[model samples]
Target chain A: DTAVSQTPKYLVTQMGNDKSIKCEQNLGHDTMYWYKQDSKKFLKIMFSYNNKELIINETVPNRFSPKSPDKAHLNLHINSLELGDSAVYFCASSQAGGGSTQYFGPGTRLTVL
Target chain B: SQQGEEDPQALSIQEGENATMNCSYKTSINNLQWYRQNSGRGLVHLILIRSNEREKHSGRLRVTLDTSKKSSSLLITASRAADTASYFCATVPTSGGYQKVTFGTGTKLQVIP
Candidate 1:
């Protein structure tokens, strides 16, 4: 079984549309994260959740919101998406806090036309 | 500015040779991690070295951390075509709980036969 799983491996939608990417990790990890990789392949952290508590929400636009229904499930909802929002979104999970290694999902390719 | 920037945006090496990549960060970190991405897939954790440690090894990979210079290096021994992928360095901030991991741009490695 995949330790960390993400749904909608590919998402291609028009601008202004709202979409949600679902992530789940069965590793019993306490921390989950959402990352965005731009065309330049620069990976940036968008949000982090620990036991369903909002931790780090980077300077992302208001259109992007992360909802953690529970410790195992973390979803990202982007409203009124723009063309600039096109990128690869990754979901990751880690067992302990800061010094540990992270396990990543396959990622969802979100293309806003 | 990005927290970690990898040097030699890309590298090509012959089979059986060794490949080296460097990463530099601007802030203090509690630990450094190395991950490998194969093609368009999610990243896989390779190794991690704490701030107090200088070197670590796993399988054919060797990671060196220099906290004084705020830099790190990943060395792959006996490179093979199977090792072709992108290598990234992630920094776990010293002050933040392990959730604040920031990834570098990555170094693309192509193992030539």
Candidate 2:
């Protein structure tokens, strides 16, 4: 079974438009994370949620927001998307606490024209 | 910010060869983990080594950790074409509570059959 899964494998939108990406994990993990991979292939963590509670919020712009309705799901919403937002967004899950192994989902390629 | 930086951004090798990737971090870590990502896919957990541990091996993968130097290395023996992928090192910092997980700049490996 696919332990972690993401919806909308590809998203192409115009500048200033808004978009959302969904993530789900069947691994019964308590923590979920959102990461952005730039064109240079640098992966950076943007947000992390533990049992639906916001735990980690990086120095990302306010235009990007992450919401976790339940422990099994986490979603990212970006407002006023700009050309700089054109990158791949990855979703991952892990057990609550430090040093836990993470399971990642197929990334969503976002293109902001 | 990215905590770990991997050396040798890319590596090319023939089948039956060994591949080595190094990662260096700037902070004290509770553990270091290795992940592999195939093109257009998500990251997959490979192995993990704790701060107290010096080395670990799982099948053809061997991982070494040096807490004094804040560095780690991953060695893959007998690489195959299927092993071509990007390898990343993630560190769980000793601080930051639950937000300590950080990924490194990945090293892309090309294993030719």
Candidate 3:
């Protein structure tokens, strides 16, 4: 069984359009996180939610928003997608503690043209 | 600024050869983890070493953490072609609240069959 899963493995949208990527984890974890990997393979954490509560919010642009409906799901919504938003977004889940292991979903590649 | 920085951005080795990757961080961390990401795939957790722990081993993977130097190293013994993937080091800071993990730029490893 897949522990963590993401929707729309690939997304190609024009600039100024809006898009959303959905993520779900079945590992019964309490903490979920969103990460953006740039072309250089630099992975950066964007947001994190613990037990459906916002916990970590990095220096991401205001256009990007993360919503966690429950402990098992965290979705990312981007408004006014720009070319710079083109990157692979990953969702991960953990047991909600420091030094806990994280299970990652197959990333969603977003291409803003 | 990135909290963790991996050395040797890229490495190529023959199958059966051992591969080593190093990571350096700037802050006090609760633990450091090593993850592998195959091309077009999400990151996979490999190993984790806590600040108080000096070394750990799992299968063919060995991890060592030196908090005094603020550095860590990952060693893969008898690497196979299947091990050709990008390896990253992630750090969980010692700060309070939800400890957000910061990932370093990965080391892309290529194993020649």
Candidate 4:
């Protein structure tokens, strides 16, 4: 079984549109994260949540927001998508230990035209 | 910005060969972990080494960490074509509690059969 999963694996939309990507993990992890992979293949962390509490919110733009309804699910919503928002969005999760390894999702490829 | 640095941004090796990728970070870490990602996909956790430990081995993957130097190395033995992927070293900074697991740029490995 897949440990971590993300929906809308492929997303194509026009500029000024709004989109949301959902992520879930069945690994019994208490923390979840959202990372963005640019065209250059650079993976950058955008947000992290622990047990439904927002812990890390990187310098992501206000147009992008992450919401965690529960410890096992975290979703990202992008408002007024722009051309610069075209990239792969990955969701990951890990145990709540001080030091733990994260398991990633299949990734959502967002392309704004 | 990335919290760690990976050397030899890209590597190519033949089957049955050994490949080594190095990572260096700037801050104190609670633990270091390795991840692998296929092209256009999410990352998969490989291994983890605590700050108090120097080395750890799992199957053909051997990881070494030197807290004094703030560097680590991931060695893959008997690599196969399936091992051709981007390897990343993630550092869990000592300042945070499991939410700051930052990833490096990653080293792309192309293993030939």
Runs in model 2 deviating more than 4 A are none
Q: Score chain B of each candidate by TM-score.
A: 0.96, 0.97, 0.98, 0.95
Query: Which CAPRI tier for candidate 3?
Result: medium
Q: What is the DockQ of each candidate?
A: 0.77, 0.80, 0.80, 0.65
Task: Supply candidate 3's per-residue lDDT for A99.
Answer: 63
What is the docking quality class of candidate 4?
medium
Positional deviation of A61 in candidate 2, in angstroms?
1.0
Clashing pairs in 1: A98-B98
Q: Candidate 3: lDDT of A24?
A: 96
Stretches of candidate 1 exceeding 4 Å from the true structure: B97-99
What TM-score quantifies how close candidate 1 is to the native fold?
Answer: 0.97
* Candidate 2 lDDT by residue in tens digits, B58-108: 999999999999899999999999999999999998886564678899999
Residue pair clashes in candidate 4: none
Q: What 10-residue stretch in candidate 1 chain B is worst by lDDT? A: B93-102
Question: Model 3, range B1-113, lDDT digits (tens) per residue?
Answer: 89889988999999999999999999999999999999999999999888999999999999999999999999999999999999999999998676778899889999999
Candidate 2 local lDDT, A36-108, one digit each (tens) = 9998888898998999999888899999999999999999999999999999999999986647999999999
The TM-score values for the models, in the order shown, are: 0.97, 0.97, 0.98, 0.95
Model 4 lDDT on a 0 to 1 scale: 0.91
Q: Judge the docking of candidate 2 as incorrect, acceptable, medium or high.
A: medium
- Model 2 chain B scores worst on lDDT over the 10 consecutive residues at B93-102
